[model samples]
Target: MFYICDERGVWPRRQRRPSDCSSQLVRVKLIGEVLAPFFLVAAFEPIGLWFTAPIAFAIYLSFLKHQHRTILYSIYFAFTANLLILYWSGAYVGVLPWVALSLLQTLYFLPIGILARFSNNIPLLISSILVMEEVKARFPFGGFSWTRIAFSQINSPLASIVTIGGVLSLSFATLLLAYLLITKKKSVAYVLLSLSILPSLVSVIQDSSEEKSLRFTAIQGGTPSKGLDFNSRAMGVLNMHLAESYRSVKGDEDLIIWPENAIDIDPLENAIVREKINELIKRTNVPLLGGAVLSEGPTNAAMLFREDGSIGSIYIKRYLTPFGEYIPLRSISEFLSPYAERVDDFEPGQVLKIHSVSGSKVSSIICFEIINDGIVREAARSSGLMVVHTNSATFAGTAEGDQQLAITRLRALEHNREIVSISTTGPSAIITARGEVIKSLKDGEIGSLSGEALILLKISISDYLGGFAPVITLIISLLWALSSMRRKDNN
Candidate 1:
């Protein structure tokens, strides 16, 4: 839309208009820019075209020569990708909050595009994007660590290295492969191609130790109602879970776990509820770890019942759900949704709680806390087994529960520990150290999973050095950008 004035073209009549072909070319480029990130969205869950991220990035990189165009393209891509993948966010809450969230997250890409414009090196460009993802995963609250590029490759060939370096490692490997392929430098490409086969190599050399297994039941008690009002009848919700417990055919199960908010009323305070649970314990003849909303201001806690019928240590949920568990800036946020006012602020647990259920030591992660790096890593280091107690009742029909299950599968691989993820409304499963779902239940299915898992006492490298990989990558990216800028100045 800009024009150059020729010396003879001083008058408007003498000036020439740009060609229509140039305008048409701009339109074509803009269309491709928009489509690039659209394909990236398809690479995530539900549709799950896992290979599109690199292609999308390549298209994005093509725009870097024009800085203004690159910035606009990056924003458009980020916003579109987030909006598509996170459409489920608006399922419970309205569209406004969801759109706001997507827009806020898109801003993370703005600086990334600016930094990427400074460097043409494959490694630097790849590292900058990785660092951008890391920042988005850790800010403005406890962080929303959903739809990470690594999560898309749960079933990928390179999933094995997760034990050595965690999810960020998987992301790094994927980006590296993309870069090598694009460069088409046979030597570098061959090196990366060979490196990609190492997961199979590591699998051959890794310990295939056969440990004794412990039996556990992951209970999925259906909600009273399906949507946001699923827990409207709180006591009825408790009764439904209690009914599901009695209905469960107990085999030689060592322990039973219920999802978060299985018991809306605190069994500890109410003698009647306590007596009801005690009766179930006597009938099942097994200890249980189930979630409860305790009343000295409604703390989300895991109530552990001992085999001796005594109430064991209550493990409180450390990381509470940001808006759902407690609405931050309630006064300002109330405008976003009427449900904001409906949310009561629950206090975050002071300590990470790992308890012994019928002799097997299991760490409890309530709801979305399983997505947190520090919390999950701490639990994996200390405990032999891990359990995620979640209430997916709010997001029953959406892909949210399935996405959460995907995350749980990655966690099982990352920690190399057996995990029992029990949900309020289905997608419950018992996953092994190798990330296989031994047994699983579908969404909204009123069922319980009884399976055995080998208790892995060994911890992973990620357990020892949590979040360090991303931090190191971020520093390297900054240095690479600075070095590139310096070279340009010297020229």
Candidate 2:
């Protein structure tokens, strides 16, 4: 009988059993596959294990052995990763909704799973990830775009790709290097790594110029204690912002920006509210972009107040958050949970308004509006400065604020413009065009950020193309995969 030895061509002719060696390898591979995705979950939010993201994903892809188990494994991986990253959702809306949302995100990975099963080519797999993320960014009520692959790389070397092709480009380049490393394509990996260094070098050159700038003050008013109840105490919330506005004033600010919902009551309708806001603007002798809730069925808006307290143009929030702002399928949602009653149906603004504030064309995105690519694209095209006015008081103590800040950093790089993101209940920051956080206010703190920001009309290639890169790449990948499968079948 011929023996199949585990140890092949040993120096001393030592032989090992095939079953034991094969089983050991299989066990190691399985353990690696499972552990890889767990680490991927850490790539987001507070933990920010960003360096592990590409490596973890590469390991997961390496062990994708069976076509029949592709969907099952992918669902498991995506669900677990999303569940960990989005766990904070449970603190507000309950565990059920969080689980349901995580499950929904799994479908986004289904296509990538199928693609991985059919091909071993690295580029195709990377393209599949982009396609999955692109699809998930759009569906099910303007999709949950948090924890995108590129978001993990916000602080990494790959961030330089943002100015070139936006978030999708960074993701593609990272995955390319990751795949090459996993496949042991050392020569190609080294070459690509060298090329990756070029983007960061180019970014440094672009941001080196000292240009004209305007000094601005950003106010973060701590909520009347943190929780969902702060919104109920509208007057107190407004007073808090008013007080902070007074405290933050340095007397030299050319412009002042407040966090979203700074005025819980409509200033246009209330003389008392208008007077208080105008008082601050007048004292500072600077224009202020203050957030307010307008009561034509409650519109979330950022109204620009001139030095004399005269109202300039208003930029109302265009993308209203589905559950938080307006409960979808209200009747059904209310029946499911009592939390639905807490949210009033907020009307979305029809126009993407750009305001000329103190010589700078400002595109203000209120709160969650920063997540929408189209909204951000319009903002970049319309103005030289981008401001994200947000209130994270409800999600206080959670990683939601940090995650949002990370996304804002990506936006700064993507547009090659400075972003002043001011949030209530802390973590207000100033991000430069290079995606660097020059200044910041920590979460759960009451403070202000003062910085000099430049006005630049430069629009990135990614901004011009919008979602074209991912959509076009997705179509090409799917077609290529189909053609390859057909050729194999014919043979």
Give the number of the best model, judged by TM-score: 2
| Predicted structure 2: clash tally | 0
Q: Mind giving the per-residue lDDT tens digits that candidate 1 earns over 1-491?
A: 34323453211222344553355655676687769878778777677676787677666765553333556777888899889888888998899889988998888888867764554454566677787677767886778878677877677666766776678877776665565445555755765566468655655565567556678777787888977898788788778877888888484688878898888877878888888788878888878889999997679998888776798878888787888889977886899898898888988888877787556678888888877878888888888888889988888888888778888888988888889999999788888887888889998898898877677777776665677855754675567547756665211
Task: Provide TM-scores for the models.
Answer: 0.88, 0.90
Worst 10 residues of 2 by lDDT: 8-17
**Superposed Cα RMSD, model 1:** 5.3
lDDT of each: 0.76, 0.78
User: How many steric overlaps are in each model, in order?
Assistant: 0, 0
Give the runs in model 2 whose Cα sits over 4 Å from its true position.
1-17, 66-68, 115-122, 187-191, 201-211, 471-491
